[model samples]
Target: MLDQVHLPPLAQDFLAYLSLEKRYSPHTVQSYSLDLSQFFQYIQEQYGGIALDSVKAAHVQSWLALGLEGRKKAEDAHKRAQPPASAVTIRRKMSALKSFFKYALRKGAVKQSPMARVTGPKLPGRLPVFVDEHVMEKVETNQAGDDIPLFSDDFAGATRRMILRLLYHAGIRRAELTGLRDGSIDFSNGQMKVLGKGNKERIIPLGTAVLKELREYIAWRDAEFPGYAGGALLLTAHGKPVQAWDVYRTVRKALAQVTTLKKRSPHVLRHTFATHLMNNGADINAVKELLGHASLASTQVYTHNTIEKLRRVHEQAHPRG
Candidate 1:
């Protein structure tokens, strides 16, 4: 199944744009490469290892069939063993193929986008589970005490707590937080440079509480690691840059202490941040821009939350028995 075959030229060009023109990092480039590679492998198997340029509509249809197979395999894995892929993983692979074909069509490398005419398998939306404002406030209250044992202690405990609050308060993604450096924070203007999807940059505003915690955390960090702090904001005990999983584990552990929400990942907190803002009367379009969602359709899930709340209010108040 691992034969060596060149990708369609369009995919190659896209990779060039991703790295040279867009300046995507190595990890991002590799992810796109894996996505495209998996797509082509599926296509090859569907078409009996046909030539790269020979693919047609039937091949695209077959790829969707392969997605179905992947899901079936997932179900069997649950009963007897571990699934090699989740629904989310399959969806992502499909998205990668869709983007690749679209790029090929746009560049005239392919006659048309195969994904345009082919229908992808529909997936149900699984809304994120996040703690309510009351519980989040409880977390804040619990973590508000001064640095124990010494004013300038390790600060790892306090710093990690601030990271959780920052993610919950601001709807930025985990990559945005992990990619952050000390210089990314423009404290005077109270904004942060957040690198989001596709390596795009945006400025995010911070609340007074997050800002205060960050300033104190920075001071504490400097005190502990004297002459060691360079730029990265969140760091290990040894002042090294924080990784993506580090932030995820911190959020998971913090949420476990104060909330019963099952999904406690950083992105869940980001989703909670948006829905809560909308419930509290923030503009929907404003949330779209802040979360760096390319389309408002992607940001419209919060509207569902609003609808549910209104339905409950109507049922409780406007009863006509």
Candidate 2:
């Protein structure tokens, strides 16, 4: 819930709009709240508490500068120095302020948005990391080249394997995977409905092999815990619903076997799914829909990976004159 007492009326109203009207996740709402609170506090400390409507672009720029340059205390030599925020962190704060002010403008709370002229620091371009196709194939089988079974044989092993497959094949986020219900999967249609960020729902198509594995896993799960009638699609060993960390640990452990990437998480599987699809000639718009991205820009990042792959192929195949 939003802290009503600390925030100004307009800020609180903006947060409420984000929660009720915009349908932002609790985490996202809390982030906006924190960002607004921090900015307000900074205003109070730096400028003796300026009115919300009175805040200007200069104040926003100064706050961003403070993020880059940690607050200094000249008198306290022994005090621990505050570290500067990362570009990403500052960028998020900037975004939060922009959104809040935009809301305020729409609601007629302010004559103009202070964040209108404020520009965030430029972020460096980073390509998404993904496991190689050969390595991914190796992930499904053991060292002896035997196909891993997801049946009544071993519940724990089957659960872990199923988690890895769902993340890779379905390309769902950790939260989406954990929040899934048994009814989310439409076996007849070979598709699964996932609730994504901002409470947006999207349908992802499942392949025959993945669908078969899912059926086997669900059958084993139901048989193992007959008394369990929970709505969650995935469960823990204790028959409780799976959490974010559960998905992360499973992906990390499984990916550790096939690849040595520094960052091995459920999102890497998501990246892998998109990267593979782009490499194999999947339409960008289709990939966007599959990944549940709100904009074509978000989905366009995968094209960078495709371009890099093509660069490598051209270098290898072309002969120098």
Candidate 3:
């Protein structure tokens, strides 16, 4: 929720920049808009005559505190109304605030950024949970895909399997998976351009193993639906471009067979890809680039997985008397 107060000229501009220049995905943009809107509403109702753009660090801390100018304002109504948000939620809200202030700083809208030195609640160090290597190997195996049943041959069984393999092997985000166009793939070069968040584009290369499967799938697709779409690479059984839901369903069904992940979403595959790479000794920076992560901090979480692997190896190898 954004602040109820009228947005300053700069705040509106910042939102526009996020939408136009930054090209944040719709879901992300919508969340940002709501977070800001909620903040503004809280400021107006709680502080009465306070200027939202001039909010200070204390305001941010107070907003994040339980029962203080939050979603359920006034202690009387929200009394004993569930505990406040967890520290993790507080941390994320702070991050959103930090990003907003940074944007404001860039535009010179606010002389001093409120979140410049603000600290949010300390987040608990939750160990990264990853699939066991043996389990992952079993899960990633493309063999079981052969025994799967299909509702129709329109998307074709092969198409579904190829989709699963691409997401796992390439570690491409689901949106990036859908964004792929036919011409975007370079068979000769063995790479494809991935459009990630913030309109950032990067090239993802595939090993010969994945490239071979891709070629076979493409050939099959062409034979089934010759002269189908203009540039879109993946298509539904009816030769329509792959949608987000299609990718979700494909990944979900595949994971149901291989993984016990409760959510079994495509992003879990992305996490699995990063964790596996780190455990195998891939450089953190290199993994960051491969995933198109904007900040190294975001990628560093994978280090936890590597550390866990090292601990296991040390415990097994070292003999303690």
- CA RMSD of all predictions: 11.4, 10.9, 10.2
After superposition on all CA atoms, how large is the RMSD of candidate 1? 11.4
Model 3 regions lying over 4 Å from their true place: 1-118, 125-130, 144-155, 315-321
Evaluate all candidate structures by whole-model CA lDDT and list the values in order.
0.75, 0.85, 0.75
- In model 1, the Cα lDDT at residue 222 comes to 83
Give a tens-digit lDDT track for model 2, residues 1-321. Answer: 223454688888888999999999999998998988888877876798877789999999999998888756663466566788888999999999999888888888899998888988888789999998898877665431355432224777777777888888888899999888989999999999999999999999999998998899899899989987859988778888888988888778777766789999899999999999999999999999988999999999999999999999999988961
Consecutive 10-residue window with the lowest summed lDDT within model 1 = 144-153
lDDT by residue (1-321, candidate 3, tens digit) is 234344555556767888899998888777776667766666766787475467898887777774223444355574344456777767767776788888877767678789876777677776555555665565445444466443234546677766777787788999999988877789899998888999998988888887887888788888888776566778887788889999898878767776576777888778878898888888899999999998999899989878877888889988961
How many angstroms is residue 176 displaced in model 2 relative to the true structure, after the best TM-score fit?
Answer: 0.4
TM-score of each: 0.60, 0.62, 0.61
Cα lDDT tens digits, model 1, 1-321, are 334363556677888888998898988777788878766766665555665446676776665565555445464555344324555666676676777777777776677666666665557776556568887776666642343221123477776776777787778788888888888888999988888888898889988778888899888888888887477888787678888888998888777776677788998888889988888998989999888999999988888887777888888888661
TM-score of 1: 0.60
